[model samples]
Target: MSEMVSHSYPRVALIGECMIELQQHANGTLKQSFGGDTLNTAVYLSRLLGSAAQVDYVTALGDDSFSDAMCQVWTDEGIGLSRVQRLPGRLPGLYCIQTDASGERRFLYWRNEAAVRECFTTPAAEPVLAALPDYDVLYFSGITLAVLGETGRARLLSTLGDARDRGARVVFDNNYRPRLWRSVEQARQAYRAVMHEVDLALLTEEDEQALFDYSDGEQILQTYRAMGVSEVVVKRGAQSCLVSVDDRRYEVPAHTVQKVIDTTAAGDSFSAAYLARRLRGGSPKDAADAGHQLASLVIQHPGALIPRSVMPV
Candidate 1:
């Protein structure tokens, strides 16, 4: 495989929500931390890139202590926070995770009134939206679309178009949550609206099936190709990850894990590593390998983030 040309010190911005995360144990105890899909990717991407690139997170949060703690964590991880908005009299979302013995997870959320729902709709958001197009890369997920509501989604779509027009790459992760939308058709509409603006799509086979009722991976790839997406990666848990770049296809095998603990942030971490490797000029196969390796390590831990000391060298 040919290596992608490396870009110099790319500035990346990830847009989404970060919530107060609670890990519910079998003994009825709860462990509190902060996590969200885009935020998790931002943290991992910053750690992987270090001084090689700039990674920033764009979202709205309340002035609560939880929000304070979240900002501190992001700051310590080397993620830029110049675009974060603090809204008064509001709070971030909250979610509780329950993990099965096999490391599968179920989430219970109380986020309908989260401050991020107004992320791109607030009066203060005009400057943030105006600044997004200046970045080298913009990243967001299906959950971001769902949470943004109609007004916020419209603004985000416009910003994405402007970003692409200004020569920025737009990376999208199809992390679909059925309950987040009022109906399947609504979710499909929102997804299709943003698909055209996406440059690279990191998708899960299961999410594609559940969201679009596609029969197989080929259908998914064909659909993306038809939509003019330049590069696409399909991640299948414990199986090979399929990559389609410049009309060339490759399947990279996932690393084996003997024991699984928590599956939280598995795909998020994978996407981060894949993007980081690609930014460093790795081939698609090499990037997928990096993704699988990091995802394997992340699942062995208990939360969205593992201790920095255990990061692979």
Candidate 2:
């Protein structure tokens, strides 16, 4: 209800792995970049907010060449790296995105050995965990939890509880990866526990359906609301996205794009812009529109991150 730009921007942290992304084109050439759901969101959120907000990435990467390149990209994008850790000999995950003529994407992952798996359990993680409560906003995803293993997930959940108690808004993006878990029941338990601490939730309708077998998006909305989430957003790809806060619900359509080169990070960027707008005091509807606009443009490009020169201001 207040003007977003009127107040000082808040600090936001996004936690997840930044994997080595390989995109293969029809011409047999491969494009290289670093991407992960939360990292992608952090980059776009930083780009959208600029100096208005402080954006930091929270993850662990290897001290290898690929990880070095990844950090360089993040630094150049103006993303803070204070919370990012480097483990010796451990490497980041690798994933390749293959798209068909219809712009549909298929992912092949090799992330079982990523350094982020121990991100929350390392002796060095104590300080990071303690400092989390100081952030204005803490953002993470299903993948963030899954990659951490059970002990790490428990630690993270504890931090989320503590952070929420400190008046920091905990935002969750349900980027569920079925293969990451041993079984559906295990994932449901983990997500349900963390869901209780989430103030803002960005959920993809499809992922919810896949993970929880929700009859529809409306059921998913009701489920999150029952779990005490203050605001729940449902993203339906090229379709409309729904937002609900308490008893009120708003339906907003996604931007219609004539072309979609790759869908890599569309939801991730959308979440970033939405949170950035909300942190700056923009209304929920305005934030959703900003999200859709950014995602539409992102899909028109080839990778999770577009060139900074072409980024939205």
Candidate 3:
């Protein structure tokens, strides 16, 4: 297979939901915004790849003002919206974040009836599924699986198979949230099913430990290797990241952030930069370096998205 970055331009699609994000301040003020793990990655990926790749976000949204604003922001970031589904009468989910003095963040979610939960199950989803295979890359996270529910997940699995058969590479982010599923066993089953189709997996070590109870990095790496995933990157915050590709291993140290103002999208940003660099012809090590570089900058900001002016050159 050719290097992902070898193509002059490629089409990449990311699947997940974006919610209305509120940052609750110590003074009890709330700053309304929008963010989601996959959406965060999409924004950063589009920024990093520029015109070199066509980045699209695939999700269901309400035909409300919040959805309108979200679409506008995505367009401003150069992300394509052809794959987005706008459900009538429904609204996007909402979440609020509170950060401690140490800059650690906690979240409260209110997404049960979000339009994205019916994303792949609705009648309108059929055409979107049909067009997914045309992209060069298909990316989604574990949160996506949880929101899709069983029926949507089955449809997604079938769509993944067809996309893979069409030579589209599948990228997965292990953004596991236990509260999203009925039980750990159910989440495990869903993750296992999706893992089989993943070509590149960007995982956080702590999420692996929480989800699978895996003892250490070696076991996690071996499990992904067993799943036939050719490339895996284990992100360890504040420590070195581990990369496994074709039986070779590389340890790339993370860039240290002097003070983390907010760690909201650290992993998401890292995955975006890593994938963007790889798509731009950087080697695994170089890609990891890019991931760390971007993540380091992101943590200095107060939200999931930093200003465009502060973006690294």
Q: How much lDDT does each candidate structure score?
A: 0.92, 0.89, 0.92
Write one digit per residue (lDDT tens) for candidate 2, span 1-313.
2332234878788888889988889887998877788989998999888988889999999999999999998998899999998999999999988878876778899999989998998998988999888888899999998999999999989999998787788899999999999999999999999988998999999999999999887998898999999899999999989988767888889999997787889999999888888887778888899899899999999778888787777
Distance from true location, Cα of 36 in model 3, Å? 0.1
Instruction: For candidate 2, give the lDDT of residue 228.
Output: 90
- Candidate 3, residues 1-313, lDDT tens digits: the string is 2366346798999999999999899889999999999999999999998988999999999999999999999999999999999999999999998878875779899999999999998899989999999888999999999999999999999999999898888999999999999999999999999888889999999999999999988889989998999999999998999999986899999998888787879999999999998888788999999999999999999788999898877
Worst 10 residues of 3 by lDDT: 1-10
Write down the TM-score of every candidate.
0.96, 0.94, 0.97
lDDT of 3 at 215: 92
The residue pairs that clash in candidate 3, if any, are: 5-279
TM-score: the better of candidates 2 and 3: 3
Off by over 4 Å in 2: 1-7, 25-29, 99-105
TM-score of 1: 0.96
Q: For residues 1-313, write the lDDT of model 1, one tens digit per residue.
A: 2432236789999999999989888888999989899999999999999999999999999999999999999999999999999999999999998877775778899999999999999898989999999999999999999999999999999999999898889999999999999999999999999999998999999999999999878888889989998899999988999899986998899999999887889999999999999988888888999999999999999778988887776
Off by over 4 Å in 3: 100-104
- Could you say which candidate leads in TM-score? 3
Q: Give stretches of model 1 more than 4 Å off.
A: 1-6, 99-105
